[model samples]
Target: LPAPILRLAAVLITSGLLILGCDENQQGFLLTNRPIVYLGDISYVVYLAHWPTIILWKSVSDSTSLSIFGIFNCLLITFKISIVAHHTIEQFFIRSKVKAVSIVVSLIYGLLAIGLMFNVPATVNTSVASRAASVDVAAAIEWNERVSHNAYRQHRPCKECLDDPEGQRMRGGYTGKGDRFECIWKPDKANGSVKILIIGNSVAHLAISILKPVIEENFPQVELVRLYSMPACRPTEVVQYVCPPYHKALPKQVQAMKPDITMIMYDDAILFITSSKIGQERKILKKTFNKYKV
Candidate 1:
């Protein structure tokens, strides 16, 4: 399935389907079906309503569960929401016959929905106001003066970010080669939180994208410990990578940080290539184990 050929085929198929559907003479069986016709009226509403429900369901439980009852429940819930949305929101707008009002409502709903999805507040409360009111003028002025000198640290687009400003360093916080401090991220908060160290390859990085959000939202107390990784760098230190200057760096970092637990992510396929140097890998890895003193 080359991309170009597949794309060309998709275009041709879509065009053919459109051409076939343009006929008033050839009424389709699906279009004539009672259930489908009912669904067609609220199809857009179903699509809109289902996404949030699915996201919620996934966050709470297994998204890929194939149990028949689970599938039925998901569909039933989505259908019920779609019915409500169609009758109340969708049909109300259509009957009102105000395209401008509909567009405005749509934009407002979309923005609010997107905000809530990202855990943004829909309304400000007393706590927010209280915090703003509590800021002292003297402290603010002092902070402003401090910012005047070390302004580069406040890089725009990522200013005062998460990850410990104090402890962050590159090469998994290992002091090696050039400064890799900016590349490494440690927790600025969660002083009493359990430390977790994660090291791995590209796949691991993708997992981190999903992980970082969950940890921030649910386990904010836990510090994300050493996160040393590059595209092809193996925890076994048998692969060559261009970044982080990580050759023989993991053991020293592990001893230094003393993470509560260490997690390693790697591509098993690379094992074949690494197998060539298994003896050296064993020796290097054994040193890490011995230092752990477990």
Candidate 2:
């Protein structure tokens, strides 16, 4: 038989046994008497009250573990509360004809819970967007500087920041600093051409070798200035941290080099983690791009 049917059969069999065992007076059973019935009633109280009690306790304490002593304490408190609530609250409510009040209260509580659940995503999105819009490029740059200095204290060179010399030689002898870096290709100082600034993290930086040839072949006479950072630094950080001070200052750096195109790149996974505060980084990136847009 199906599981539900099997479970129903079991319950029916057990109930039949209990009824059969009951005395003609219906005051006692074959297994025990009034004391056993009372104990069973208290056991039901304990089972019903234990879970919510534990949840509330954990929420307040921020604790998940229960030692032997803790378990004893919990049981003591649970039993005391359940006994009082059962007598003063549960029995009163059960005995009362308050069906209408109970139904209305339950409906209100369920509706409120559902409303809060729907509102969560909208709240998160708005908060993230507002935070992003407020980010100042200068402020972000300063934060990055502090973070980078602290990171250096850990005494490990981020391998992602190192340049691949073999990859560089194979692409063509373009000179640049770091493991993944960008160098501008200028034909002449006086000649005006479309400037392309490529920005991204390490993987995007490596792809620059492939991109350089394509750009050169397709768009001849256009000057290409590559701006890149390592690992998974977002474009906002590239502007604030890596590019400014390290690569050179932003507008001044771009203007002096004079480019027509700015290619911004980075790992989407990295951006998702670091740029959780929606608008700030995106705004900074767009602002920087607009400054250099031709």
Candidate 3:
């Protein structure tokens, strides 16, 4: 249970396993196996590519969990890909005959990356004026500038935050505020700011961080935000809710806190058992904010 005991147990178990691995035939089989040796040769390549491959696979499949067999199959597929790339892409470029072709390929890849980094759309939308009504170009520019700074020093892309059409719409900026809960030196304008309460599922988690800085820049007058969310706990007033008991009591708690503008962000996933009641939730939200209207 303790750290030192856990370490000792792990070492003992590993030592026992190593001592038990006395089968020379098993070792010889692995050493001589053609497929195993082939995979071993490109293990480093598989190491380099497997993580990104798994991430891409998860994203494309929209899968949160994979079985043991599924993981094995995924890794097998990745190994196959690694072997192919090692022969075709990596070795082909290294050959003297393909040196110029490699340069051209590299240039094309570089240009494509540069285009995405600058958000160069493949097709231009000519409706400038109507689109301008929707986007905060200045805020977007500021976000792009601060993206690298925001990623905790490691260079990472914020495509979902800055590039996506859905993401742009969600950055509507906080229109509310409240009293300082924890900041050390609260500004004098804090009391004057509109208090915002965001209640939803894990979607609120993304909305919270992504929207915070943009809201601060857009509404200099408003400064307070409170977010409460759980992964599967969609807001609903139905009799059979899968939400935590604490979460079920949050509406009454919000009534007591008296936020100025309450945003009821909900997952719109279709469900037969329990659905997030957006309209009824909106009515509840109205009632919560109405207390502070005076």
Candidate 4:
């Protein structure tokens, strides 16, 4: 549908819903019921928190899809959180004399200050040798900078790039690279940069890291663009916590960059699926690939 038609349709639908909701003549039992009224009260809070809850669930489970048990637990948790937020934060903001905007800004700055204080040591990129040299005492201090001694840490965060303990041994915890999931790598502008979009999950990151030197040496014109890489996420129709952002951003990136090539590297099949859903997932995956392909 066109923009006007879509807007008209949305208005009509909303108006219809409003009319039905306000209808005194019709049976109001469902709308007036305590449970329904309570849900209505907390619906906005649920709207705001549901997405973060799902992402947190995915992080905790390390899986894309939820089981029946997981869904029940999620709903239970969401409702509990929503009810609490509705009664406390939501009510306070709605009813308080103090400006909500000012309070929110103050809270944000306070949390930022705390985070900076805690994270400053980890983000410091200077070598132990450099720090040791700065302190002017004649005490012999031996610092073993390499924890896992894995070369992969030089490319990206070993935590983000590697999954196994064996690979992790090479990575000393997470490098600052772990904090970023996406960035564009620009080759030297003097050589003439060729934009090649590198996308998909961590495998794509690994692939580019391995192949990057070869590209720079052989294909001197190629510039790497890392758009998105979320674990257990791919360009597919299957509803995972990460897929929506990937899909939403792809077209915008494509439009903006107009890359000469778009390379997708991920697991061939959906991360989580039943035997029965494989065929359906395969079709959806194919469709998504077709849609996103440049």
Which residue pairs collide, candidate 3? 176-194, 177-194, 177-195, 178-195
Residue-level lDDT of model 4, residues 69-144, one tens digit each, is 6566888889899989999989987787678757887999999898788885555645544776766444332122
Best by TM-score: 4
Q: Rank candidates, lDDT, best first.
A: 4, 1, 2, 3
Model 4 weakest lDDT span, ten residues long: 141-150
> Looking at model 3, which ten-residue stretch has the lowest summed lDDT?
178-187
Q: Tell me the spans in candidate 1 whose CA falls farther than 4 Å from its real position.
A: 1-20, 28-33, 62-68, 99-294
User: Whole-model lDDT for model 3 versus the true structure?
Assistant: 0.50
- Point to the candidate with the largest lDDT: 4
| CA shift of 205, model 2, Å | 38
Predictions ranked by TM-score, top down?
4, 3, 1, 2
Kindly report which residue stretches of model 3 are placed more than 4 angstroms away from their true locations once superposed. 1-28, 55-77, 89-136, 141-227, 230-294
Question: Model 3 — TM-score against the truth?
Answer: 0.32
Q: What is the alpha-carbon RMSD of candidate 2 to the true structure?
A: 21.2
lDDT of 2 by residue, 1-294 (tens): 334675899799769757866756554453466655655557668888887777776444333334344455778888887788778766776677789658867999998888788997688788987888867968888756634523432322222223334323423444334443544344333143455555555534444444444444444544434443443334454123223233333344445444445555553322221223334433443444333212
Give Cα distance to truth, residue 176, candidate 4, Å.
33
Worst 10 residues of 1 by lDDT: 268-277
> Which candidate, 3 or 4, has the higher lDDT?
4
